[model samples]
Target: MLSRNQWLAVVLIGLLVVSQLPGPMVHSVSSRPAHLLSTLLTPLSQWMLSAGNRATRRPDLLQRREPGEDAVRQLRAAREEIRRLQRRIEEYERIRHRFGEQLEAFDYVHAAVTRWSGDPANPWLEINRGRRHGVAEGDVVVNYRDLVGRVVDVGPGTATVRLITHPQSRLEVRVQPDTADEPARHHLVMVDAVPRRGRFEAMVEVDADAPIEQGDIAFLHVGEHRAGRGWPEHAYGFDVGMVTRIEPDQERLPLLRKRIVIEPFRDLPRLSNVTVFVRREYERPDDN
Candidate 1:
């Protein structure tokens, strides 16, 4: 028997009280009303949100990309590819110019290092080339002019290389005085691996005034001792590393020789790619 306005006020008050009830009670008591209200207000809510976004100058990111934007992205990618190729070409050119005569005797197989193994003191690299790609067990792996390691195990699709830093590795190397006017006096030394240390150590007796500096390079000595080794004859003069530190050999009573440390130009553990030297069948002594 209440007026129409009084009935509306009562209903609104009831709705406000129901909204404050516990979620479970409100859900059970007003499921139909909630569904109908949501359905009626959804379009209006969406329109208000869109209008706000437009007012803020925010574009809809879910929309399809424009044709011009796609073209620009493709063009940027193509330019990057060209730059990468150019840099690779420059590297090859530098290698050819530096080791022209030495590289002519053998062919190189490119390989990507896929994994590393062994303890830190005696680590090894696994490359993605195997017998199928002419990579033999004794094949020498190198990064440009730096001697990396020797292949020890080979599978059909992969090969493992024992790095030069292995505890058992030893190499014959030579260092020359830093004098340019005088004849190059080669200081021959046998470098041995130091356990747990990723460097080579050698003892050489130098005159007090000899110009052996820290930055002097150590080159692999390829003579009668290494003549029969599995290494390619062309690898005779590759760089081993630079002289990092020199200290007096205390173990020696007279202290006549100094112990020098040689570190590779590149970090062996961080190598991503290497080249394998594959010997060709039948080589002419006079070739190149």
Candidate 2:
């Protein structure tokens, strides 16, 4: 009788003897076993080689790609910076076009408003420019042709501004005819601040036939009265306010007078920046 180990060894010896035999019979017997062994071992060897290559090169690939990502981030930041600068340039160009002949007469300084006072009726602003930056008391502050205020107090690098809404502020203005062809008329009037209202009112003494109405625009007049009023000559034609309401002046008789309530073209509390018209050094009388 044969044991299990003895039987396995006798079977392997018989297969080897058959593989070495001559003729087509031996190849036919060996072909299937040889094909099965080749199929299994070939894929295993290839998978191990591919995995080892990936493990060796992964860190190098990440290191090589880091600088490219950083450059992309830096490019985005630079584009944003360029856009900001272009906006500022376009703004200054628009201002120059609007106030062309006027801006040529004096040097101007741009200042940033740093603080807004709580009182709207007597609103004031603190700016980031002062005496050292050529800002001075009485210098007119404006956003284009819209009147802002005057510098009241100045330090080495800071200054305070009083807005036109203040109760003490007054300006002489002319309300333009709504239409150009409506026969040119001088609608001259004096605008005064309305206490606690943060606005101005002009009372006109006119006959019942006066042509004043709502929607008319008022502009600061440039005349002999402006010379000593701490206002620059270039600020003469700046916009002051617009006629918002028209009603009868009951205190003076409806037939003889009317009240024209004016509202500023720009809201004071929203001011963020202003241009100060600084006196030219060469034209200063004291310098001569």
Judged by whole-model lDDT over C-alpha atoms, candidate 2 comes out at 0.65
lDDT of 1 at 219: 70
Q: Tell me the tens digit of each residue's lDDT in model 1 across 72-118.
A: 77686556446534643554465566666667756799886665653
TM-score of each: 0.56, 0.59
Q: Candidate 2, TM-score vs. the true structure?
A: 0.59
Tens digits of per-residue lDDT for model 2 on 1-288?
999999999999998988678956875655445434433443453354335434542232113323454777667645644553464355346556666666776788987666656576677766777777777778888876578888876666666788877777777777765344343654777777664444334444445556777766677775456644456666766667667778887887887777787766655545666888887765545632
Give the 10-residue window scoring lowest on summed lDDT in candidate 1. Answer: 57-66
**Highest TM-score among the candidates is held by which one?**
2
Model 1, backbone clash pairs (residues 3+ apart or across chains), number: 0
lDDT of 1 at 135: 71
lDDT of 1: 0.64
